[model samples]
Target: MMMLRKFKIVLPLFFVASLFISSQTNANTDPNPKDKVLLTILKYVLTQGHYHPQTIDDTFSENVYNSFLERLDPSKRYFLQSDIDEFSNYKMQIDDQINNEDLSFFFLVYERLTQRIEESKPYYKQILENQFDFNNDDIFDVDYEKSSYAKNTSEITNIWHKQLKFTTLSRLNDKIIAEEDKKKEDETYQTKSFNELEKEAREAVIINMDESFERIEELTYSDWFSIFINSISEEFDPHTTYFDPVVKKRFDISMAGKLEGIGARLQKKNDYTKVSELISGGPAWKQGELEVGDYITKVAQGDGEPIDIVGMRLDDAIEYIKGKKGTEVRLTLKKMDGTTKVISIIRDVVELEETFVKSSVVKKDGRTFGVINLPKFYIDFDEKNFRSSSTDMAQEIERLKNENVEGLVIDLRNNGGGSLKTAIEISGLFIEKGPIVQVKYRDKNPDVKKDTDPKIQWDKPLVVLVNELSASASEIFAAAMQDYGRAVIIGGRQTYGKGTVQSVLDLNRYHNLKEDIGALKMTIQKFYRINGGSTQLEGVHSDIMLPDRYTYMNIGERDLENPLKFDKVPKATYKLWDNYENFNQAIDNSKKRIATNNYFKLIDQNAKWLKNSQDDTLIYLNYEAYKKDLEVHENESLKYKSLRDYTSNLTYTSPLYEQPLLEKDEDLAEKREAWHKNLKKDMYVEEALNVLSELKIKPQYHLVKN
Candidate 1:
């Protein structure tokens, strides 16, 4: 799967909708009365306040119809062709239903899906009762998007058999290989027969399926209703989403950057919850067991019996993993290499320190350069005095200047944006003062967000590092730097083109009802660079482009459905930085170096190989053929193994002020050590420093270290 770790909490600005509901409530009793009110408010706000509201017509209806069904049964396994045929009747009529606040289509599909899910349980149980023939030459195409739904119950049963057999065969192969390896390790080791191993794999699949169904059975009506609502909301834009009360609470916690848990983000993949990211300095990271891609199979509290979580809902699985601070939560993980490990962690308040700005000083040749890695433009919306990225960045710059670092590299790679105000503030620190970005609401003239502060904090040579994952506020900062000729933008062909600004509107505020109607995160404004170009579809083009893993992949805002189109506005008045005499020369020199660099060449080749591998999703169900395919890919992957071992000739160290803090806190020390080590291996940072070194400062602007 293509893992795009997108941080979608962009610019948390709130705008109260000016909606007024009449005192006349619905006299007719309905189970979900709030649904109608929510839908009515949602339509009004989206059409009136959205930056580019989509037309809700027959086309919109068809899109939602297709999207909702696909989401309900993505594998094309649950619902049959008959079910699809029935659902298609209201495909075009959905627009009218939505306009009238009618829930007939939603109710029909929801009820049918619930019925189909219950019916499909026996199919898997019956299929797994017998051994799968691994010797047969069968191929399972994993491209479910292209696969057709089964015509009848018999056809669906056959499809289930193939899918279960594919799942079992893979496990059987793993068991066979493990037995052989054990036999080789000890000459007198006993090995089980193929039939015996096949039975064990089948049993394992049964357990997993049962747990999956159990989790599905636990889904409440609210869960399904949220999905139906989102299916409509997402058709407007990818980022715009409806957050039910439960999900909205989670979003708030995530934005606050403090949670009482083990500090690992989990995503449901197939029947397992995979570890997406581990918060640095969190309990799990401190314990040093959980890793990204590891499947969390079971979770236990304190010394209790482990509860299998392989098929559990992500929200439920998290409940088992998270606990009050000082409580123990043990997790059973199925590692990527097929080994199982039980890890215990004492839950704590995991303050996401890594989400803030962190800086490191590195020495190249004889001069020092500073690298500031800003994960996001974070700001506490609730507290005015709370730490903000802009203030932290300003302080870090002053500290770097105190250390007499000659150049600065602001690393915004993988920073999927946060606060817009902070981005503009941070941009002002580099330049004297000018309009940073233009924000345009629907049918309104562009409002210029400027940095009125004329004091330039860092007049020295500056380089900004961005990649395909740098989005929203990150784009705003990078664009401002590029437009004003302030910083030399490097890495990736373009940044993530997410120019739209979103504002969370509390839906309950529009009504006098005591019930919580949750909030709507809708796109309210589209931002543009000072040079008039919108970074909506085409992100900021890097001045010094470099090849990365996602070089050939279809990523960013344009890849998303119904993204706003790129357009231009009147350019804001801003003066270009004329202090750097060899700006063009620095870029040209880096391009020449990157052209012949073996490491970059290997990276480009690896990216192409990865793209091809991702495209070839077909799996050989026969054991021998499956093993052979894996072996071929494994050998091919060995060619790019050296990429991990490549390192640069640079020494990175923590800043002087942070040195004392690191010595006191071992976790902080360890985090910085790991960061410095990665910096040493980073070729991009090395190249960025090279460009910074080549940038010749104007004679009058040059300063001597005190």
Candidate 2:
């Protein structure tokens, strides 16, 4: 673990003046004025404001060079070893170039990249023009990271040939299976021959390939520059990134939790626009049609014909989806379960109310407990009247307290976190008054954020639910609760380990340039737990570990590329909340029950199987072998089907106090009903309830202030 320390160095105006005086030759051939200005502002911020600034030397240059190359051609599809060899001349010179605010290296690489892309477009098209032999036993390595650049043009051509064959075979296989299924459904259904299906698959590949090349051709120099700068910035840390103007707007919308259109976040996965997340109370979430893993293959507005989005850039596809609040967008989506459907969604303001704190009263084993689902630590900085998570959470706790609930569960699962101020205030609700988290800046002493308030709201037996997606502020709250013995952390092995704080500095603000140069989201600090441990890559461990599908997955800060290392500092002086002295006994009982419970055991087995399957990257190119392998995996997966239907006998309803409000708002009633129904099927929630039941401490006990 590396603890954060601050460095305060004020460079005089003459220092920047001298840098320009010594680098006049480098500017004569600069690619663009915006790039030059962007370079100056970026360099100044990274060196002066970044948390862990690496020295601008040969080592740093090498990292930037390699990272840029990887970003440009991640699959090793465009660039060959020959091109890399030719580009090595500037590998060790990028650092010096940065010092001079030069961009000669970028221009050189961009020219070559564009040329190569134009030259290579014919290779794939030519390969897909012929039929592929489905009988050939071949394997394709789907993992791009393990692949190396082609040694020569011949190898590049061969790679394209194999890739086209795999694509064509997959399409042809699906077509054949669909025809077979149709014949089974209708006795008079006409079937096409294998040759005809293969021909159609090849034609589809060519059409898709042509559109892909066309989209690739639409990339502007600024887009490439954005990637270049981000590559340079991310070398400092994975969280430190350069967002172009367009992306900055998107970031703002996401942070604000208000957007038009279908209210779903989309990402490009291998030329297909995939739904990453659905805003909780947004149109998409309310529609209950689109899912996280669904692929949006086509989009249409109003009653227009659907336009294919496959082989289109994610940004371009998003433009078609986003519209006025009253508009309508129809999406043709392919579900992960191999089902296709066209879903029509009416665009709206996407209220974002569902992300707020919502509580449900659960009656389990003849005892009532309150469960509060907090999606994120959201806050509105600009508007004082806007509802924040901390304030909303406090009110919810008060409501739950009035209901005489025995124990409370704060659900932080899938919470990516936001607003550190809100997290600090929420921590105050649990503890009387002490340090909750420590923030360390470069070369400066760690600043401990303390909750000075003496009032402890609902200091009862508590449980905090977390998973792999629980991050940053979520980690802080959970770590503080665990450190103080205030609450038992449950779910997953640990939370998402993003402990660093990022400050987005607008590049245009630093310079007098008229052009919008976007912003730099740089890591400026690392936060540590009150107990001296930094959550950086390790995150906060669950007090009571529970296995899920993500248990064996590498989806944390540690798994991310170039994350800040974890380290410790001196622990803050804070007193523990000793309300639950028999906490260890409760943990033991819960573990024992989980081991014997068929639901949990099945989940662990399913997680193991998922991990094993993910590790196998090679896929059979032959249709028969590929189909057999998929069939076997799907059949093996059927045993865990009962997990989805497994429901706990726990009955959930709004408290009597909240019942009137539910009746007043039917929408709220539906939301609560849907949430409670999901909770009944949630194995993790069931275990948390069990843990609460086993706690020796009762809600009536008053915890002594520190």
Candidate 3:
């Protein structure tokens, strides 16, 4: 959401694991026979364990070949037509090779890719070494998703030329703005000519590309092998992926939501490791010194000399920063304005409570409501007494019940979901022992996961808030709640649409192999709502739809490359929640309020303009036209700025018990206060309360169960 203007690189740096492998490969450059072993085990899983097993045939082989190439070079800027032609011979033969447990195709492609990368290094360097003619009347189409591979070296050279020029222009634009700002700040400030700025931009590009090539050299053969293996596994489904041991470890740590290190998401952006997001209540966020978009230039251990990480691989940089709890890691960061600072943070176990279930009490219109924000349906698998979202949510509900809340609102915005078992348990809190969801596996009839518990937690007026980012378990909870007429689903047009469930299988356990080949996360089941509708491509629809920034964006499972299709099963026999009889009237009242709401109108316009900008792929090479377009966009974007400041005249406060806890912890109190302030500004929450008010009205008709 925070867009850093000229610092943005159009290309995705590298696939997470691929770049990590590329960074750490220099020390141990040994041949890994595990590739064949991994391939064998992966194929077995796809064929035997996958929900939708793909056949290993000519068709599958050709897809594997193309998909691998696409993964290797998504921008179509690396390999050429000749490379594709040379690799065409193995297209159909890939099926035979995989069938025979061979690695010929993978080996051929990986070797050739390595060779092309080495050969193309100088091409970008030579291009960036010279000054770019920004005055030239040319436009670069940035959408390479539909573009074809280059025909020859000449064509590839042209593509590289355009790429470098585009990058240079972007950097130059940033410099010009900075110089102008400086001139305004100082009366006697001198600004450099366009040519001088152009040279600086080119030099910057050259330095970055050189660092990129050097880092590429660190890529081990095993890393590329993982990429290829993942390409094959992903062909089955987008959710299916092969994680090598290192990546698997990182994946596990991330899923656990607690790690003994600095709690900031670090990403490799052109030779610099940028702090992407800070985990709230984590070390970085708690320190309040490290910030999103801050470039980590150097890292050091406790009292140790700082080592420069400017051109270091992100994985290596992370290694220097990540330490055991109670240890210290120092970071040298570069700010956006080109200022530098040193910050030392004592590493601790950052438990990501923000991603867990949390509750707040809102008092509006002389009535009280409890809002529960469940970012993810997290579950700790290792510990027998591990905390789960279901238990946490139930506790929060009980806490809210003690406050005597008149209505309840569950906010699942941006929750990508977690344990399916947790989802069922969470849903059970609202209903009196019934089927939560129907899951279907390969060739198996739908199995109804029932919550046999007959006790209802808070079967009163309820509302759920979701957005396009809400997915999987979130969708399951929302859909089940919607089907039972237990709650009014609000926000986004639809959820993230991820209906399928993935189970991680350790490859070592598959064949009882003694080696740590890695793990495979494969989609093994698809879930359906209690009303029989699949939440696959079509996620759960909101009972009261609200427009947000992502309303017009292609960001759901349906927008993914190879997502599972939506279908239906027989509806389960279940009783609906008889709590709200005037649900339809309440929805109508909310829609009427939304129709005349100025905040929503502005949001709709912002969404439309944002989508238009996203669709605009062409970039002007001429600086004048480029600046003009950018200024137009900047001016247009200003109108939406007021939306962030828009706050409703509503009050949100913590429960009495929570207030004492907040009082004890100043940091927690501050966070909750900020959260309350944000909630006041949230138009969707305001409307949800209105829905709650309407739901509190007596029903004209009796509620019935299906």
Scored by Cα lDDT, where does model 3 land? Answer: 0.78
Q: What is the lDDT of candidate 1?
A: 0.81
Q: Candidates' TM-scores? A: 0.87, 0.89, 0.83
The regions of model 2 sitting more than 4 angstroms off are 1-28, 261-349, 381-385, 698-706
Q: Which residues of candidate 1, in runs, are more than 4 Å off?
A: 1-29, 177-187, 260-349, 381-385, 512-514, 700-706
Each model's RMSD to truth, in Å?
5.5, 4.0, 8.9
Which residue pairs overlap in candidate 2's backbone?
1-566, 1-567, 2-566, 2-567, 5-442, 5-443, 6-442, 6-443, 6-444, 7-442
- How many angstroms is residue 295 displaced in model 1 relative to the true structure, after the best TM-score fit? 9.9
Please, what is the whole-model Cα lDDT of each candidate in the order they appear?
0.81, 0.81, 0.78
Candidate no. 2 TM-score: 0.89
Residue-by-residue lDDT tens digits, candidate 3, 201-253: 88877776665576678778767788788778888888888888889998888
lDDT of 2 at 286: 73
lDDT of 3 at 399: 88
Q: For residues 444-555, write the lDDT of model 2, one tens digit per residue.
A: 8899999998988877789999998788899999999999999989989999899998777666655544568898888888999999999898899998889887788676
RMSD of 2: 4.0
Deviation in angstroms for 296 in model 3?
14
